[model samples]
Target: MRNVMILLLGLALCFLAACGANESTQGNNGSGEVEGQDEAEPAQNDLDYPQKPISMIVPFSAGGGTDATARALAAASEPYLGESIGIVNTTGGGGAVGMSEGINSTPDGHTITMVTVELTTLPHLGLAQFTYEDFKPVAQINFDPNVIAVPADSPYETIEDLVKDAKDNPGAIRVSNSGTGSIWHIAAASVEQATGAEFSHVPFEGSAPAITAALGNNVEAVSASPPEILSYVESGDLRPLAVLAEERSDALPDTPTFAELGIDATIVGCPRGIMVPKDTPDEIVEFLEEAFMKGAQEAEFVEYMETNGLGLVVGNAEEFGEVLAESHNFFAELIPQMDLN
Candidate 1:
């Protein structure tokens, strides 16, 4: 009986050793197959991928809002991604060029695009060759409320005065918008609808140029976010008439909102988010979302948004997708009403 018990104990010890060896092999190669056995390779880790530098394509000109946001996000995400992110400015066709490039790129997870309000509105207006379905969302970074401003020397002193002028002269008062179907243009249209007015819609490549035209007195008024016109407003070069939001902007609290005047028009501003080609691997999207969420929470990003009149709206991939879906539906309904194409 003693011999039999010793033999059983030895067998138990051998079984334990075999299990240990299997685990050791699995740990070394990340494949659970036992030594000398053949099996499919285990899933890959992100660290093993993107051996080359990544690229972030900004669908607008350099130094514009999209470019700036792209750079900020890249700076924040590079350390976590373990690779350098290259930013390429491919501007034209109201962001269609860069967006097309991003969509066509291999979805292996190295390419992403920084898009804003147009990402939602352009499709409905027949402007976007590719819809939101073409891109996989990563995260949202900022939400900027559109503002209405006029030349400092313009006769209009209030939003009411501007609306009255537009009402008095339909399609006569030239108004500058960032682009067709953009949030800025939507704000402009909202003003026209609320007040039953008409203004000649003048489109520009981006907010910077639109605001620049306003400052240069090339246009009677400009529709852009506070960030694009803050300095001009501060320097007395431009006068902010009102913000197209439910409440006044903290940056321009004294400036009233369209609602204050009994115009039920509330554009609620617009949010900016990050996206990659639709076919990018789910794991890569998660990797990017995690990195960006971490960067967004950093004190620097928060301070930057606060100082720049941009509202920070950070969300994970799933949450961002919901926001995108809602915005997509909202714009799909809104563009037809605006009669923009």
Candidate 2:
């Protein structure tokens, strides 16, 4: 009898202990927090998007300005990305081959392409199969503004006077550009559109030759980058009348923007920005945009740009995307009339 009673008591105690354990396991403190359970995890992929070294594709030669600036930007962005950035020069077909490689790359944050004005131009010219819409813009780091200059001894002292003369003598004033359908050519076209003038566009092999033609009076005026014509202006060879940019060029502080002169020169020149494949996740895209925009403001990048006379204009993803969209639309409409088939 006593043994039976003991067994019954032991079983009862075991049941009680199990009940207590169940209650404890399901219990919560007064703070409403559960006991002995792990908290929910965070959204992890964004924090760890770039899990390896990043490849930056520059669609130009290694020793050129694009490659140099791209390398500088990559070096500046490394600290923010927590991964080293490698610059790869993929040159062919005037930026088509390299850009194609980049846009067709894996849609991860590891591959970044440094895009230029050619992104919009090449497509319209039938030079490239892909358009700006194929990629997501991260940020713009540079904008080489176009400057309109005449020979020092020319009668047109101001941009207004230059336009008036061109309007008076339609097709008489020859304007030189880098080449047909080039960004500088677009700049010259912008000049004619803004002022309602007709210019005889003489496309040279490149900006140097175009500027040389202006210097030697082969053309009445030239549209080119600020750096290309700075020495000539300093030497009193070319007289800068206006700049086709959102603001005046640092190299020619005295020259006014087309906007400042009541003309809207909407064409952009040699704007360099970072981009990823369009299929890249939005989270990764945002993360990269933050990194590159931060890097563009770094002291190293700014100093390098200033020393090299490269134009430094930084903007976030939204702004850069807007620029690409605007340029794309403008070129789409304008190229049909350019007769570049």
Clashes of 2: 0
Go through the candidates in order and give the clash count of each.
0, 0
Top candidate, metric lDDT: 2
Runs in model 2 deviating more than 4 A are 1-53, 60-68, 89-94, 149-180, 193-222, 227-241, 245-247, 256-270, 306-311, 334-341
TM-score of 2: 0.63
Q: Give the alpha carbon lDDT tens digit for every residue of 8-123 in model 2.
A: 22221222233223332223333444344332222234456678899999876564446767988988778778788999878666677888999999998899999877788878
Worst 10 residues of 1 by lDDT: 3-12
Tens-digit lDDT track for model 1 on 255-332?
A: 897767777663635667788899888888877776666666555555665576665556567656766676777667
Q: Estimated TM-score per prediction?
A: 0.83, 0.63
Give the Cα lDDT of each candidate: 0.71, 0.73
